[model samples]
Target: MYSSLRSLADDTFCLRLQRAARVWRKVSDEELSNLNLSEATTTPLWLINKLGEGLRQRTLAEHMGLEGQSLVRLLDQLESAGLVVRRDDPSDRRAKALYLTDAGRKLAEQAELVVRKIRARLLDGVPAEHLAIVDGVFDKIITAAID
Candidate 1:
């Protein structure tokens, strides 16, 4: 009986975490849309900018937890918008290196600001100690999942 109760509690905790993730993504997407970006594009752009111009698509996709084809589509759109460029990798002729264009860099900066504001709003009432605990819990969760 005790084991069953523990299992139920664990399940409920997982469900709550999933629900929170969904809500956060939905809200983020809506906010990003106003800046002519989607949840998909904003993170990639920001990461590319931070990672520097010669970052590989595969690396970016891995960091973003996306499949290759999905990342390709996002890159296609970004390229068409003149926000990103896929340059031929000097070391590997077949591979393309990802780089943000001038426009992309500008947008990335703005995206950073937007993200900061959004994070502030989302964490407004949360106490620092609570946030630290949550952060630690997430770190453990991610580590466990990865292993």
Candidate 2:
């Protein structure tokens, strides 16, 4: 039985959103594992690749919505893994700039393809117009939550 929009939004929307996120992550992790990557592990590499090289560490943390120290730990692990490196920023010696190694760039590209495959599978039959509308709603919700 269909319910009122207000009721559904108030009671079910958040749950559905959370479930969708969980499912997306689960599928993404499983697929990425084929390349010896997991969502948590691939995220920083992918983000750096997407945003371009020499991104400031503080900027990366802000983009990731992570605290600086928390991001530092991840960066340490990535550096040790030889996927990323931190260089002293030319403009600010105390600030670190992040860059992906050749291996990291290659892995990031592969992870990107795998993510696209998972996204395509999940949105196989979704109408573009409906997706646009949903995206608009999501944008507003995100803005409201952040504000």
Candidate 3:
């Protein structure tokens, strides 16, 4: 039966977390596919929506933890899809600013709804107190990893 829970140890938490992340990503990918989007495009789209027009490509790349060329490739795809645009930065003639097209803005709204649904499903039955603790733990882990 499901007797392995009896033998679960504290040290296995990280392994469990990794498995959970993988599963979540799989589910998210599947859900996003219905909208003709993938996980790769979700964050950047959301960021563009949140940061508004005139967001620099370099700034978005930094926030996304992606290299310049990598971000450019993703942006290229978005631009080709007509979901985003790259305008010349007025203050910096050499740099490009990121902006969502009208279509991009509509997709961003849909993305937000999808994200809300996913979060609700994922957090279902999880107590708020427990989630707060988990959030704090994640912050600590991220800070430790960065340092």
Candidate 4:
């Protein structure tokens, strides 16, 4: 099936990206489900871990492209699960800084492991140069889209 309105090239990249994301999420979820975590849940942990100290809710929401309320809800869930904590920022009186508990940090590391394994599995037969080319192409696509 194809769109009558646009060329195949117009939709093919988007379709492939969407499908790839779905496949990655599905496999990641399967692995994380045992720990009651999905790709969605793991994302915040990953971001927090990456950002290290002084990560704020406002900044995190911006990174995730989520509204403040949505991020707060997700954070609430994580907090309740004893994975994360928010404290008054030392530098900024109004901002709340996010810190991962030992459990949260551990989960973030586990999530990274799961992602790396999945990536290796999916690209096992692909050449390193080919992967690099694909990465470069996607980088261009992202830059163009953002601009």
Candidate 5:
């Protein structure tokens, strides 16, 4: 039945996602080991590096699919390491905007290089033309998941 087929497909997709996530985590851990940063700290650093200044921690947390408490814990680590700082929002005293320190920016750039290299290695044998489709599929998957 179509319903069963759909369920099967969903399960397969989730399994593949988990596998890929595990691989990514392992690669990141190995690559970032020299920095003495944990996965939790690295996550916010990566997000802040991408979003830059003026982004709210809560909003960024939602975008990254993390719950509030988890995000707070991550932010605490990043703050303690002097990699990021939270400033009082001009419009809302209760809200805070995240900013990356110069040190954070330098580390983020290095981390990006590691990610790019790992991605390139993973896609090494794939045809160049297929990259567009691969990117499209990832976009579609993210959109669908969000929706």
Candidate 6:
């Protein structure tokens, strides 16, 4: 059985994590809320910034680990938000390519800063040497679940 102190310690850690997440989200949400960008667009926006240079939507979807209608829905929302625009692939009329708009690019830049600030705040109290251990444990858990 867990002792009261042990339980209290676990609860305190969980509370801190929850509060950190909330703070991180607040920074993002406050920064982006007026821009009409949804939180879901964050991943797709990053993907576009990384690989949308000349890739097709289908490839982007696969890269993002999304499939079929779900990807379509995300793409639709992004398109509707004017953050991303889809155009027919000149190489293949059947395929479409994606690109970020000027506004999207600008917003993404601001979002990046917000994300960095959140990271800074979260890691402020953490020692650099312990980061590797934290990363290692997270990677182990993720790999174990995926594998």
- TM-score leader: 1
Candidate structures ordered by lDDT, highest first: 1, 2, 4, 3, 5, 6
Clashes of 6: 0
Residue 65 of candidate 3: its Cα lDDT?
74
Report how far residue 76 has shifted in candidate 2, in Å. 2.2
TM-score for each predicted model, relative to the true structure: 0.88, 0.87, 0.83, 0.83, 0.80, 0.65
Whole-model lDDT, candidate 6? 0.76
lDDT of 1 by residue, 1-147 (tens): 547988999999999999988887887888888789977789899999998889998999888878899999999999999999999999998889998989999999988888888889989999999999999999899778778
- In candidate 5, which residue ranges exceed 4 Å CA deviation? 1-10
lDDT, residue 138, model 4: 82
Clashing pairs in 4: none
All candidates' lDDT scores?
0.90, 0.89, 0.87, 0.89, 0.81, 0.76
lDDT tens per residue, model 2, 1-147: 457788877768889988998998899889998988888778899999999899999999877778898899888888888999999999999999999999999999999999998989999999999999989988898778779
Q: How much lDDT does candidate 1 score?
A: 0.90
lDDT of 5 by residue, 1-147 (tens): 557988999889889989988987887788777777645567778878887786898888887788888888888888888888999988888999999999988887777777778778877898978988878988998889889
Clashes of each: 0, 0, 0, 0, 0, 0
How well does candidate 6 score on lDDT at residue 12?
A: 90
lDDT of each residue in 1-147, candidate 3, tens digit only: 345774565447878989988987787788888888877787789999998888999999878878899999889889999999999999999999999999999998898788789889999999999999999998898778668
Please give the lDDT score at residue 136 for candidate 6: 92
The candidate that wins on lDDT is: 1
Q: List model 6 lDDT by residue over 1-117, tens digit each.
A: 567988989889779867965876676666567665555567678778767455689888776667757888988888788888888989999998888988777777776666677
**Roughly what TM-score does model 5 have, to 2 decimal places?**
0.80
**2 or 5, which is superior by TM-score?**
2
Order the numbered candidates by TM-score, best leading.
Answer: 1, 2, 4, 3, 5, 6
**Runs of candidate 1 exceeding 4 Å displacement:** 1-3
Q: Candidate 6: how large is its RMSD?
A: 4.2
